[model samples]
Target: MPPGVVSMAEALANVNPDALHSTQTGYVLPEPALFVTSTLQRQRMFLHHWKLLADGFLYMLGQEPQLLRPQDWRAVLEGKMSGYGRTAGLQELIRPALALCDIQTIQGLPVPVDALPQFSLRATQEIIWEVADTSFRFEFCALDKRASGKQWVAAGWAAMALDERHRYVLRTAALMLDWTTHCTRSNTIHRVADRCPWPPSEMQALETAVCEYYTTAFYEYFGRAAVIPMRLDHDAEMEDMEDGEI
Candidate 1:
């Protein structure tokens, strides 16, 4: 394997945490930021690896990695065992997962909204607020009723792609982990709060508070920014890359 595929711990040890935190929108992140950055770097590395493995694995597996069939399990296992596979044409797969990730990386998120068994209308509204809270508008959008959900789906992926700032936050946070104690079992919410910039110990509580705060402020900001009377349209003008509109 090439050196770039090395474990994240080995790849980004010398990265400057202070630089990453400062480089962001003037937020003084805690030490945990390093681990976040490392995680993101690893994801990018894996994404590249996925693309690289596409061809050989597709030929061997007899299908594209992104569209594996039930019978394709054997090939998947074989590829893993052999350390070869690819992720070509995986942007469709990548966008949804990465969008959730970008949000978690920047905002110090909890459970993914998509992972929920179902979404309340209010919950969906809240999610949009959180997405906009970071002002990374392109990361979240709704499907227009006229487009029959197509526009929203496309917009959703586009939003994730256009979110450059969110990506930077993810890369930065990956570096702050001790790698040993960042998990929920190791550190409680209060512990994180006491030691880190944002605190209160329970991870769930932190997630909840952050979500509530962002959601509230996000709607308020949107209300203030609105020029004309408009209903809350989640997925509007998502079909094309409308600059400065997001």
Candidate 2:
């Protein structure tokens, strides 16, 4: 574990699992559903899922400099790749997030003139329009949707805002998972928390928000079972019951 990263167990010690459950449980499960019968097991499954997402996000942070300082919004909008994005796993992790942004382009590039903000003025904190040598003016904005009862807040240039939003969502999800797992290492969890862009309080709030969002999403995708695998002991119990019946 790196310095400052809190292990998943330590972080999850403070999380309330009941707060992570969803009311809706009628949706169809995705193919190859994860199956867990207990809240603790479900929490573990969630943590494992989040770890995969965190690995993908960290890979992008290290491999794609353009994601942090993108000069060409068009390329990013088109799902352009440089390093880890070329890999199969990372690509699967990132593509859906990138698809959320609405990019308007003409002739394979963004329009030269400034367009309306993708979000409402009330939803934005700051806006920037930079004129490039190509006579194109690039628009970027810092958004604060929290004022309107939304959970996300992020700052970046152009399409990068979408990336920031998705990154925030993933990080918050990871934090929530960390709070739910008891087996995580302390140093590892501390280190993970240390890398977060937001302060501890903010991250906590974001974790609550993201957890709520994902809980609903998980239920919708996996139904009430959430598709986590049953524990070996549970299987043993089932076997015992069958033997007695026979």
Candidate 3:
């Protein structure tokens, strides 16, 4: 709340405690996991995804295709092809995806991933997206069992929700690189043509190569159901099921 820094207490306060427990049926991080960061990283991650999601939402609205709940549809954004990394333990997996997009830009801060709050959905995306965007040098620690494949590929369907500019692909590329901390602790491979998420007609051109350029370093970190998916109701209005009173 102080300028760019948003506390876990403040971020979690936005969600209903009940919803948090209910949504995380499979895997949920233990309490006291807060991803603190500079105001700049926080703001950077928030605005970057906000603009992307906003654009995707508007594009989908105009296309009038059957839409998926933000959570369900967002899952396609997860998985290995997207460059989402996996750690051996639960705690390490939940670490914040840091910002390495700009090494010079992030001169004083520790990696942004360390400070990400678990339940803030938008915040998580900010973490991942920022990690993807920031261009930095050096490597990050790993969980275990690193991958040999040194390439990257963004999951195909994950980008379906996005626009033609392949914003999600670019963001996913950034995520794979930053999430794995330059492949020090994780084994994220960037294989082209293997993770195509577009229609057949859209394939065979730059789109094919474009889709292969990104990968998910870790999906569950950002898509945990505990962080209630932002809901869109019948009236075309944004509804918060965890409206604080719940």
Candidate 4:
């Protein structure tokens, strides 16, 4: 045995087989005294032991159906293990049964949607918003107070008006915000915002360039920015990047 691995016999001994059996099959199958350990190796041993128990349960159902009863088999097949209920852990134990029998294709037993993990739209939106807000704040600090205040107001309105359905557009805007913020922070040639003499038109041009760069990034990440609605489009100065334009 490896340093971090336990044997199947050892794992089976620690846990009550009756409890394990009851969790898997409605009826208490069998119990025997066993040894147990609290090591990472025990996880491997546990999985292997579970495989043996699942195999034996199926075999019993085939040979002595009367002993197990039909409802008990139905509960197992439907992922409704006794004490475990219909949890992911129980589902893992029953994977063999799911594979052996085409439980999915069978008329009434649809797989549970929550059984699989999925990416969340809300979480993605929150990330985009964080990136956008950070970028806006960083860039706003580079301008004179009056212009900075106006830009701050505009940025806040833009963030507030952002539509949940247009996350891709929000992502593009965030990328542009990051680019402008980085450029402003790194430009040592100009005096700091309080003393800098850069005019409003120059600042506006810089913002325009950032928007252009954002369009290129958007096209590279997603095939086309035009797929997003016209109302959400910000880079009006540049032509839309068609498919394969990158």
Q: RMSD in angstroms, all models?
A: 21.5, 22.6, 18.9, 24.6
lDDT string for model 1 (188-215, tens) is 3234424444322343444333222222
lDDT digits (tens) for residues 47-155 of candidate 2: 2332223333333333332222122222232233334333334344355333332212212222222321232221111111111100110100101222123443332
- Candidate 4 residue runs with Cα over 4 Å from true position: 1-198, 226-246
Count backbone clashes in candidate 4: 2
The model with the greater TM-score, 1 or 4, is 4
Q: Ten-residue segment with the worst summed lDDT in candidate 4?
A: 27-36
- Residue lDDT tens for model 3, 143-237: 11122234433232232232443554333333444333221222222432345554445333433332222112121222231221121112212
How well does candidate 2 score on lDDT at residue 162?
A: 30
What would the C-alpha RMSD of candidate 2 be, to one decimal place? Answer: 22.6
What global local distance difference test value does model 1 have? 0.26
TM per prediction: 0.17, 0.18, 0.19, 0.18
**For model 2, what is the error of residue 217's alpha carbon versus the real structure, in angstroms, after optimal superposition?**
0.7
Ranking by lDDT: 4, 2, 3, 1
Least lDDT summed over 10 consecutive residues: which range in candidate 3? 135-144
Clashes of each: 34, 27, 35, 2
Error of 1 at 128 (Å): 13
